[model samples]
Target: MKKPFRKKRQGGFTLLQFALVVLVSSIVSAVALNRFEYYREQAEIAAARQVVASLRTSLQARAAQLLSTGRERELQQLASANPMNLLLWKPENYLGEYYAPDPQQIGGAGWVFDPRDRSLVYLPRNARSFSFGSSKLLRFKVEFVRISNKSLALNQVSG
Candidate 1:
């Protein structure tokens, strides 16, 4: 008597197939994570740059007003009251000081005036603060350079 026919069985994936799928997925996830991190950093850098630009414009406008109005003494007083006014234009490391100029503090450390060009320079602390949500805080440096009136004119500097 002939034996009943046996049937072949094929259903779930083999071990090799499962491992390949897992490996591919892990690689894809890693690449995606790396790209995301790069974009985050780029965004942070751009924000920092924008803050610097705004500060520069503000300082320049103030300087021009003082020069055009012949408010040298007031400017000096303001500088003395807030030394950071000068240093804010210069590119430097953040030091955490944001005092406005005062007459008494004029011509001190972190403050310099170009007599020939009639420009003042200083550095201020907390010039730029970047936050990622409520978690991270980043600080940036700012530099100020005041050229003489003649040089300023030649360069067509605008406030």
Candidate 2:
């Protein structure tokens, strides 16, 4: 008795070809993901800026309303007061009524106002990961544009 030999059939992808394709695609994927993460962070930063702008507008509007009337003493107090510490407890004040700053409203950034310089500050919760002097440096710089009684100017961040 005699047996006959048969040839093997070829497949779609060989081991080395598959490995090369996977390696190339993985490197490309890594680069794309890195870019995507950067864009996402930028978006978060932009959202934070917008939130600060809204808050500044409200504060300026209130300040204008207060200054327009003959309530200099009360307006002075409100300007010097911290919106969060007092407004959270009491929304109504001599300047006018306003809501408190809620972190949840601004994606968890703790909102604080510096009456000395009149700058609205917003720092991401993950502040430590930003810069070397993250404690002293503000990742986002907010400007009230104008706090006069004519019209409220939205806050703009200095880049």
Candidate 3:
């Protein structure tokens, strides 16, 4: 009668069960970390693309204003501006530093705005030199192009 009344009591979980729990949690965490990294890269790339889009839209708007508002002469001048001077400097170089950064700006990642192609080219300053133009590679290690806008200062401009 006493043996029948006694209940078999089990001690907590086995070692194998604990180990499996830990393994499952670690695998879940690893997968989550990988997902976070992928999304982070995508966000950074999108930010760079927005930079290109803003530049393109601004150039087109300025050109259209100049062409339609009795400022055709100025628009024509910009259209004929030298490519080296335009991308290298700007339509009005003396107005301000518009083509690239002050060269002393933070990161020194000097950029060139190609109004013709609606591209914001990132021309990084080399470690060997402080000048952004020091490397005549004529290629950007990273560049983004905007496809929606037309070239600025065109012969005919429309909204």
Candidate 4:
């Protein structure tokens, strides 16, 4: 007698196929994570640049006001003062004035004015890829600079 025909078996992925899929998935995940971290660092740097630009503009405006009021001598004082004070609104990342800020205490990407050093410091959250030379913190100081024979300007000097 002839035997009856049967359909072929259909099942889920085999062990080898499953392992390959997992390996590819993990590789993609790792690459995506690294890219995300890189973008985050770039964003932090851009935000810092924007804040610095705003600060320079505010410093110039304050200096101009003082000059108009005939207080040019007082312009020198701006060099040591907290530049954040000149802004109408302080950035949310600003941690206010600190005499000697401890990096461990500040803990993340933000701004702090060190009264002792008379410098504005920026702490990066993603500092691993950034090259800050000997120090990880970026510091800036405001100073009056003579640009021309009859012109004076308030400028931000990186420290």
Candidate No. with top TM-score: 4
Candidate 1 per-residue C-alpha lDDT over 87-142 given as tens digits, one digit per residue, 9 for 90 to 100: 44543432333333332444332333333333333322222333333323232222
Could you say which candidate leads in lDDT? 4
The regions of model 3 sitting more than 4 angstroms off are 4-11, 72-150, 153-159
> What TM-score does model 2 achieve against the real structure?
0.56
Looking at candidate 3, the ten consecutive residues that score lowest on lDDT are 136-145
RMSD of 4: 2.5
lDDT of 1: 0.46
Which residue pairs collide in model 3, if any? none
Q: Candidate 2 lDDT, tens digit per residue, 68-140?
A: 7866556555544554433223222112211433335545444455444554455455554443242422422
Q: Give TM per candidate.
A: 0.46, 0.56, 0.46, 0.85
In order, the Cα lDDT scores of the candidates are 0.46, 0.51, 0.45, 0.78
Give the clash total for candidate 3.
0
Going through the candidates in order, what is the number of backbone clashes in each?
Answer: 24, 0, 0, 0
Q: Candidate 2 at residue 132, lDDT?
A: 28
Query: Model 4 clash pairs?
Result: none
Query: 2 or 4, which is superior by TM-score?
Result: 4
Q: Between the candidate structures 1 and 4, which one is better when assessed by lDDT? A: 4
Lowest summed lDDT over 10 consecutive residues: which window, candidate 4? 149-158
